[model samples]
Target: MSAATLLRDVFGFDGYRPGQQEIVEAVTTGKNTLAIMPTGGGKSLCFQLPALVRDGVTVVISPLIALMRDQVRGLKEAGVVAGALTSGNTEEETDEVWRNLENGTLKLLYMAPERLASNGAQRMLRQAGVSMIAVDEAHCVSQWGHDFRPDYLRIGDLRRDLDVPLAAFTATADEETRIEIVEKLFDGHAPTIFLQGFDRPNIHLAFAAKDGPRAQIINFANARKEQAGIVYCGTRAKTESLAKALRDARHSACHYHGGMDADDRRNVERRFQQEDGLIVCATIAFGMGIDKPDIRWVAHADLPKSIESYYQEIGRAGRDGAPAETLTLFGPDDIRYRRQQIDEGLAPPERRAADHGRLNALLGLAEALHCRRQNLLSYFGEDPAPCGNCDLCDKPADVFDGTTPVRMALSAALRTEERFGAGHLIDILLGNMTEKVAQRSHDQLPTFGVGKEYSRVQWQAIFRQIMGHDLMRPNAERHGALRMTPKARPILRDEATIDLRRDTIKSAKSGPKIKQMVSEEDAPLLSALKAKRRAFAEQLGGPAYIVFNDKTLIEMAEKRPKSLDDMARIGGVGTKKLDSYGAAFLAVINGEAAAQHPQRQKLAGRNDGSIYDRLLETQATLSRGPSGTDKPMSCSASQLAKVASQKPRDEAAITRLLGDRAADRFGAAFLDILRDA
Candidate 1:
């Protein structure tokens, strides 16, 4: 049960990833540890390996059931004994887990924090011979953390009850949150803390001011068509609509939100883990414990609540140390929305103000002038050379002396008694003699028309940057009226200068199209590899990466492995995978047609599954009828799924499936797709 033996024989790795061995050694030596490793930095191994070398079952208090189950599944695959007691499990599954624990067979037992509420939880762990307590998403224990869970507060009690050393892990935590974690979990007792690097260099960072955000998301997804990704939305409704839009684009997409039934959310989680090229449009509800390592990209349709949330969200991609991409879209509306949320929350004034400051920090990152990685890492107290992986590093933003315009906007706000929001303030500055302006006699103000050199849009951009810089803030008490902060006086008095990114004013005007992953000549081979991967995944009822990740497939296409020895040499093709799937994929690369999954075979030549796909797309597009002239009407999920599965052969059959009224709106388009099919 040596760490090196477990690493080699059980996990199939020769050595530890950077920052893992130290953590593993500390945890194995029975030290109370707090390891702040970045996402995808093998945080699980630090605890998992220690559990193997330790004497008793390691009780893991995880925040999400999906994360626990995924870890258990992966551990079992790696020949380790692990089980999770989750609400998602069936009675039979729970019984099996209890049996394992009672028999002293299971080495790791994962449970949600909420399970701590059970009166027997403490006694159960004590009786089960729990050795060490390892808490995942450990920052959740802190109320100041982005995702605070009240149940996590019980961990310190569990630790004292069991009298076992504890180890906590999280990807993001600031000084305040770290102190909060220490106070809550360790009772202010210092632990062996391992502050690992916060940099995820493999994840390409890009941010854009929102411009036709729906189209921007669509274009981003279309470019990486068939890649697995996640789209995070701010609200539940946005997740649904954005998911629908992506589905209309003929991608295998789904939506997840807190509002959905537990089963539905779990289903989406399962699918995202098991299916290749599946895009999940979800709220923040979906990401904390998702262990899917091969997510090629992540996009945010709206701005997140804070920088910690943003960092954690983008950390989901490129987790396997392969190149992954991320794009985040934000606009003035997002800023207002976030500010309103913070202001309206029940938090005290100081906490709310701190929340606003956090939002401003994120805004600064989004509107950053230098390397985004530098700006982001610097926030976490890390300093590194300019990373060429971020959008800013690749294409420096166009900045201009926005001092004059900012001052003008600030003056107009001050002269107006700071009672107006951006819209009214902009109108007053641009000398717009509108109904509101004339009614209020804003036209009579000296500040009026002083900013006529900049158009209304330009003035709006100036104000956004002003707010972004924390020079001005919207007072929710005054119903979002613009008010200058202390930071503004330095600029308004003509004593300080400010620069604004010109591109922020223009918004993200359709940039160059996303480049494909491989050369055109190699694309077909990559497609073949993907096809083989999908088949293997479907047969095994696991994620495609369980067969081979995209990075491995890209290597397969590039290397065109002709033998088992060659396939085994590719990264991610460990002994177990080579033994299980090496020959099959090798046959595919050798130009032999691979067997398709039955589900895939059914849609292989049928207009690319277009008959039903277009039906769904057309129905979603016309859900409100042509030109939105009718009441919102659309097929139910079951109806859409049936059509995709059944593919009715004629118009009469299609009409029978969908009623006449519904058919009249989409019958022709449906039949046309069927004809083409």
Candidate 2:
């Protein structure tokens, strides 16, 4: 049958997806080919159609037994003759595959890359009259690729041994990876390369800074309660603990990692395929082989190791062309951990540098100030318009001219001779009297105390942004010390400016508002309460709700409780919260800042808080009777807060709060402002 007739009769598809037909035509005609398509863009059909149209069986080299078996089952169900040779198969299944191969009834034979390393397997393919070689996950042949398989290097030898034309397919290959794939597989001979667009418009992209990350994951999982999903974690222990946490939250969850037993991992894989709405909390070891198409969502509990890895992992979702969602949670600690992983790897300096660049690409995505799809596609060499599907596009980032802060950071780094990490640099900028600063006399520098307007957390975020901009990078040789790139030169010299997202620095769950947290008026107070919770969480190195959940914080904001007794009466706040958080929350309700002076604390999140400051400024401007000729007089901050809160209607009431002289001096202007408010 022709390719089109075979495509219809065998696979039951109406026609190929965009760009697949050309690849099929190339492969079917025995022109060596390399096709780099997006994950859900149907890379399988490009080879499968060609395999069927060509004569003799096409030996498919897939990475995972599970992936091979899944595809074989699918092809068989479609009435195509397919079988897999893998350790995963039962003896009866292996005998059936051999029978089909000997009888020339098998149109496709799937094998893992490792089998090619054996002479016996190579001889069998030669004897079995294999017409063509189709390599799936072909990027695995590149040592430079994230999912490199050593046995893939032998595919070039296999092709030579069999003297057959080859077709390679992969979803995650940048220019470098593509080059390496060509060199390694085709031996410097260019193939018919099909580089398709990497845009996944159906996948909604999002990111959140890590704050109560467990709660964030739980909330996300609970919201989409009955959908199948995958949660990729960075470590094995995390997968297990997070899986248990999900179970406690009453979701059907399981953990998978390289550390798990073979049987257990296989069982998890089997269950994931057979069961709907099962979430597999796993490390990178899990998703590469999963062929499930209805995975409704994918979340990264921690940042993936690189951008390529991230794209491939999230691509596992929405494979059926339905809308899929993804959330990647990142933090300063995650950045450090990722950097350390790269530094500790044994890759050469150049490759390590490339790896760092890949990581920087991911950081840029996390801190993206535009549509996430735009940023993602731009990395893969596509220039697409804004996709109104990401969190940023839904609500454009709150951005500010961060040029001043960026310069301040670069100046501190340069003045320190580029020897310090973010912590010491932040200390120098904030003028902290740390022993290291005293020993190095960095506190005496000009940049010291210049950044006190921002907190340490905020500065860390700025440093992350600098790295994300590729204006600065971590020095692996110097133990992750900061180093400036030429990109920072103009910014440091005051010739260039930068804008940063203001909302991301606030919290991770800063996206679409959580439901029923508080009334509109009480939202700010609830936010302040969450900030306090985050502070405590950061200190304890725990998730935010270790102190109090949102419900409790929502209560605190709404009640505006006055004392420990009042706090104890709220739900979720028992004796422990009364003792531990009561004082701090009471202070917040009384309009207190964490470190600000008592007077300024009253000015937080309250209308009068702002009005009180406006009154002070109005008093200052008119203190000398608006001309500097009259006597100077002022109202205390408390007196200003009282007057602003009471909003005295006339001079008689104003005089009661502020003495007659001070009140008479500032009353008229204050009344006008208060009346308007």
Candidate 3:
């Protein structure tokens, strides 16, 4: 039967998704192919339809037993003969699979990548007349990816041994990962690559800084109530606590993590698949194998480790193509935790540096000023117009050119010999007479009391943004001491500038007070401000309230400030706002130069900004008095920026960027610094 007829008769689909037709055609024609489609982009149909059209049984090498079983069960339900050979299979199930193979009735055979390890398994496929190989989650073969399956590497060997046309599919793989996939799977031979668009419009992206995170999660789940969702936590304990919290909120919830008993994990997986309206609070271990498509929402209780991991995790939601929502709550702790996780890993310096860069990309997304989808897709090298589906699209953030404040923070880190964490450094910035400040004599520094514009909380937020910018880093060896990176040096030298989210910088008080956003008297002005907010939000493509919530606007309207400084005195108006709507709102109240200063900046600091500086310094040391130096000796600032920005996970890309001379002298050393950074 033709692929189209099979789609209609077996899979019950009338047509292919946007990118699937070409991939199906390629695979159906028995050509080696690589398809990188977004999650929920109908990737299974691409291979399944092709399998029915192609002669003999098609062997699908999937990563997880659960995923394989789910796909096989799905295919069988469609009246297509399919079965999986996995450890999870009962003896009867295995017998049925073998019976189908013997009877020449099975159209598709699903097996985990681990199956490739057994010569007997390969022999079985070889004897079963396997004509084509379909590898799902193809990026697993690439070591650079977050989900590296060593077993996936064996599929390339199996492909060559079988000599079948291999077709690979994945949802997440950057250029480097793609290169590795090709080199490893196709043996450096280019396949018919179908680089599908990564945009998932149905998924509503939203991020909020962690202010009362537990309550925030409870409120989020409460709003979504009965819909199926997943809440990903950073720690196993957090998963249990959060899941209990969700249950206490009267929702059906359960927690899963790698630390759980294997049987318990399997049970949760089964429950999530079969039951509707079940919320699973889990660590990173709970996803990837999950094939549930109707998940209505996804919430991240902590920041994911890397951008790839984040994309893949969030991609799990809204897979059924219906509108789904995502709320990723992040804060200074999340950033530090993620950074420390990477730093503490056993991976080499280059891999760790690349990991840090990946984290930074996610940080940038969390602290995004405009459309989250636009910035997100850009990470995959596909640029498209702003998507109006994200929380940012609903209302934009108030931003400011935070160069001055950031410089002050950087200067404090520099002046303090990069020895202290953000706490002591913040004390110096806010002129706090803390005992630690006195012990360190930080109060005597030239940069002391420089950042008196923002409060301690506001300063902490700035430091967080600085980390998001990746201009600094926490030194693991130095006990998480805040340090300057190469990216920050330029800003400190007044040669560069950066914009920060003012709304994130200026947060609300923690203690409970008024629940209402605006007073009854300021309702109309609040509405006017909302209308203004909506306009600004549409301009930046964020949720209106996210930019300037009702409370901030009420404060703005009630105070009716006469100037920028006057409005600055309002509840949420302090801190830097480079891309701010503050000026426009100041135009609202016809505020003069603005409100008076509340007090000096104080509070916390961040550590992620210092990674890049170490990389640059490593290059610099190799450049000086170097007898083993290459002709160029050192990379130029722009070249180093390329190194810093497009973090080369491997030496090949770094070599290509730096050229032979510089790569030879500085390559290994540069990689070492990236590790420490």
Cα lDDT, all candidates: 0.82, 0.84, 0.79
Which tens-of-lDDT digit does each residue in 451-535 have in candidate 2? 9998877887887888888888765434335788889999987888898877755542223443545543354345556656777
Residue-by-residue lDDT tens digits, candidate 3, 396-432:
8898888889889998988888876777788899998
Q: For residue 91, what is the lDDT in candidate 1? A: 94
Ranking by lDDT: 2, 1, 3
CA deviation > 4 Å runs, candidate 1: 411-449, 475-489, 492-495, 506-677
Q: For each candidate, what TM-score against the reference? A: 0.70, 0.72, 0.70
In the range 1-677, model 1's lDDT, one tens digit per residue, is 68999899998999989889989999999999998989888999999999999998999999887788888988999988899998889898899899999899999999999999998887889899999999999999877767788999999988888899999999999889899888999989989999988999999999987768999999999999999999999999999999999999898999998888888987898898889999999999897768888999999999999999999999999888899999999876677567656754545445666776788788888888789999899888898989999999999989989888888888988988987678778888888898879988999999887888877667667776776687877553343366788998989998999999887776523333447565433554565566667777878999978878889888887777766656666888876676677767777666443543333333432344445456677888888888987898887655654566677877788788888888888777777766666
Q: Per-prediction count of colliding residue pairs?
A: 0, 1, 43
Q: Which residue segments of model 2 deviate by more than 4 Å?
A: 439-441, 506-677
Pairs that collide, model 2:
591-601
Worst 10 residues of 3 by lDDT: 597-606
- Give lDDT for model 1: 0.82
